[model samples]
Target: MPPRWPRTPDRNDPAFRRLEDFINFALHAAIYLAVNSGLWFFQLLNHPWDNLSIVSGVWLLGLVSHGCYVFILADYRRIEAAAQGNWQQELATELEEDATVTPDEAPSSPEQP
Candidate 1:
């Protein structure tokens, strides 16, 4: 089954972003495997293509790079921590603004004429 997010999915969500990146990499790898396998199978039958190895090698490199990025380089924890920090800062700012509002300066209901 496809994954579903508990809340609205946004690019700013670290978990969602990480999941999306991984899913994309998985799709890429799957396509690479399907295509390269088919190419190899056909090459074994007729041996017509001369640059098949070069093509597969380059594609494998790309797949490896993608895997490295998704599995090793991407840091979800840091992203989540930074997002949390931003949220905390925003909440603190809002609380400070609310605390600074005096009763006289606060918005009141419209006075009836």
Candidate 2:
């Protein structure tokens, strides 16, 4: 079964972004394996094709690059920290706005009979 997120999937979510990147890389690798294996099998059976190595080599490079980005280069911790900072700033701003409310703007309580 495919994985499910606890909440709605948003690009801003650091964990979601990291998982999505890994899923994409996994899909890419699976496709590369399936297609390249087929190509190599056929080539070996019917004599080697000149361009087959070139195609596989280029595709391998792309797969490696994707893996590198997903596993090594992605900064999920930094993203999460930035998101937390933004949330705290928003909370502080809301508290500040609430503190500035004048008596006329504030909600009134019901009068006792």
Candidate 3:
């Protein structure tokens, strides 16, 4: 079946794209929690504590895996880190070059009339 909402045409808008990702992730996590809540409620009255523990443990694993992807595997994070590293290097080079440039090569500031 086709998607309920048509595919977005303005894929270049970074803000919209990121908000879409956030919404998608929130929906999935909400569904997971809703299901787990139901499961735990049903099992609480009759099942052993050990059985309930298993259900919670498995759900915790799912959350941790999702968090790892969002925090580490996301491409934007790597790109941001790379950009920051390059900026730091450029600042260092400029500072070093300024300190080493001889008075003859340095451009003089314009004097006020």
Tens digit of lDDT per residue, candidate 1, span 67-88?
9999999977656656777756
**Model 2 clashing residue pairs (backbone):** none
| Clash count per candidate | 0, 0, 0
TM-score of each: 0.68, 0.68, 0.45
lDDT against the true structure, per candidate, is: 0.87, 0.87, 0.65
77: Cα error in model 1, Å? 3.6
Per-residue accuracy of model 2 over 1-113 as CA lDDT, tens digit each: 96678998988789899988998999999999999999999998987789999999999999999999999998786677566777666667768998986668667789989
Question: Residue 93 lDDT in model 1?
Answer: 71
Give the lDDT of residue 52 in candidate 3. Answer: 68
Residues 1-113, model 3: lDDT tens digits? 74354456453444444556666777768987898788788777776556667777787788778767665665553344344566566667768988996667667789989
* Model 3 misplacement above 4 A: 1-13, 47-52, 71-73, 77-113
